[model samples]
Target: MNNKTDFKTAQQFLVDNPDIEVIEVLLIDLNGVHRGKWIPRHKLQSVFEGDMRIALTGVTPDIWGRDVPSLCAKTGDGDGICVPTVRTLKRLPWLSRPTAQMYMHLTHQGEPWGYDPRVVLGQLQQRFAERGLIAVVAPELEFMLLSSERDAEGIPQVPQTRINGRSKVGGQLYGTDIMHEFADVLHEMREACDSMDLRLDTLVKELAPGQYELNQHHLGDALQAADNAQMLKRVIKGVAQKHGYVATFMPKPFAHVDGNGFHTHISVLDENGKNIFDDGTERGSQALRHAVAGLAATMSDLMLVFAPHRNSYRRFAAGTHTPIAPTWGYENRDVALRIPVGDPQARRIEHRVAGADANPYLVLSAILAGVLYGLDNKLEATEPASGGSHEQCRELAGDWLAATRDFEESTFVSEYLGAPFHEAMCAVKHFEQDEFNRTITPFEYDAYLITS
Candidate 1:
């Protein structure tokens, strides 16, 4: 399913959906933002044939969509060919106009561009293939649905429930009634997922007002898992807008409420289709411990990948159900790595560190790289925390700046993610950090004005 689209496939899609007037050719950047061009339907054939071109800087933009000067200076901002992924070609169900969208990665002179996030994940996938191992991954993503209108101070407001068009306050964890309040929009989202082939498994009301979590069924291919996650987010946001609401994946939207998270469940299988982490026991096999140890060893260095923004740090406060340390435990939600309590064959590690806003491709790449590192080094994990693990292990990077520095200097990250991509990520992060440090917030002015 990861194969590049052929001309026949593109022509057949056009023939089938004759009404599709425009096709959106999308490229996922380092910040997980979609940057692309909407070409006429007649041009999709040229896109599939690798004739479509976009600026090479499209994949190296800062969070605000500005080009990183360092990356741009190096490449002279040349153009790269866009190659469409056949599986991602789908019609946009939420759009009023007859439109279609497809995800693509950049290629320079017929070789995969190292700066592309999908290509980086693909490199890690090849590593797993070389070891005769396959990683099955599923992501649980949380997001908030807010009103399109803002308050007097221009702050987003919780959307009114469709049941009575009244705004509700307080968290309603797993409330079926709350789910019913937004049934019409959720049904449209589900239909969009079905059309896109995204295996959306469950929808649950979260611990914050207007917050919700959706889980995707596990995929044997990690790349496809990330693809499904990216597409699912788009589907949710698009459908919500069509229903007169705004969907945001921000990690910590409100200071008083629980934040959003992107928890991933992973299980490794051998070439013979057997779960290598299962040793016919509840405690699982040594391979599982190795993977956990690897994740713990690298969590601090890769913190920037998990929490990329200033507000992302706010999601890590104590008692927020966000892991502050690289602790591992059995069925513990407070730890970074959790071994679920289930049948041995279905046993897997649940990574709970990344924010909902993190890039799915990079998250999966970091995770699979850690697993491979642990397996190759035969690392042993620490004793699993019984009750909680936050105090049992050291904390993650203290802030966004610290995390960016850690990521910039990590030899592990450079080696696994490739020097080119590692450098590009560091450059973009540093630029964003500098921009953030130069800004003054309203809170600072209010707290210090004439008081000192």
Candidate 2:
């Protein structure tokens, strides 16, 4: 494991940033949300001596930050410790005061936490390593920009909402002048990445208005790729706020625009640092096809991981690269999986399914699981289906009653995510669905309150 900076280094950080008062030790929970506690600068000394304690509810909570009472520690109960992942130490540039941040890994009684997303990814990576195959992953992250003006009550509100609001401001692919508003912040983000020593390849303004993408180039190990993906979000969000803007990785914040999607480009590499996808076979190697076949065959079953929410499913609408089906086409945006037209040396399958909101670890785990499934079962992608996953939304389990049926029915998912983790996720999601269903939105009241 790569852990940086012992107590001497950590204490030096305290001495170096004397103005800093708080340091947040965070961990990516099961839902991919960063959850942790704020510690005083004085605690920095003992960081290397031991781990930090956090509320147990974090591991099992849903994305809205809610946890089932039946499933988690009681309100104000503590359960485990987070061994500060020393390598993830970072400085927060957006806070009113100087602050440093670090991501954590959950452990209980000296064992990995069962519901820890990081653990899930870690174990899956080990499985891949055993097969003598490695995955290099570059997570393409997209997010929306919102003007920070709020209402009189200090409530937050997005200024330009609705279709054609921030959606159709004209697709400016690589329009730097237009993106100059965010340049200083983006540059600072670069500096922050440099400070933390995170490796990222390129940053570019994307197609949708106020949309941006950052690509991280890392491979030969699956867990590292996920860690990089997880860090990318944390770094960018912290840096974005320096420019008076709130950057969000929400899957579909707006109803009428191309929503944010995190396209993962993966290549199967050998121990010799060679790509297995290119064996010089006609139309690429069979391994490449089989890898994609594995993804396609199990796409729907992983919908809960890819889509993850009712709002997330909204992003799969036609026109955007997100595929409503499980189709694969060469550089075809219409397909669920688009094979980029380029040299085989850089050949990779662009998974167009994952929402920007999806958990990086979960997303990679699903992909790794699918690829491993293919390698293990010798699955072939002979009959690629078009629009393969629209059925996920169509068959909604009638109000969270059976939403996970497809994935639950999938023996492959059962094998990949393991039964316990899968059950935990499905249970949490069902609770979320129940919460949303019970709430009455303004539309319901406006449409029926006066007329009904």
Question: How many residue pairs collide in each prediction?
Answer: 0, 5
Best by TM-score: 1
Q: Looking at model 1, which ten-residue stretch has the lowest summed lDDT?
A: 160-169
Against the unseen true structure, what C-alpha lDDT does each candidate score?
A: 0.89, 0.73
TM-score of each: 0.96, 0.87
lDDT of 1: 0.89
Angstrom error of the Cα, residue 56, model 2: value is 3.5
lDDT, candidate 1, 1-452, per-residue tens: 23344667877888999999998899999989999999998887677666888988899999899999999999899999888887788898999999998999999988999999999999999999999999999999999999899899888899766543563556678888978878899889989898878998998889888999999999999988998899999999999999999999999988888899999999999999999899999999999999999999999889999998888999988777788888889988988999999899998999999999999999999999898889999999999977664364447986888898899889999898888889999999889988978998887898998696
RMSD of each: 2.1, 4.0
> Which 10 residues in a row give candidate 2 its minimum summed lDDT?
391-400
lDDT of 2 by residue, 93-114 (tens): 6567878887777777777765
What is residue 191's positional error in candidate 1, in angstroms? 1.1
lDDT score, residue 184, model 1? 96
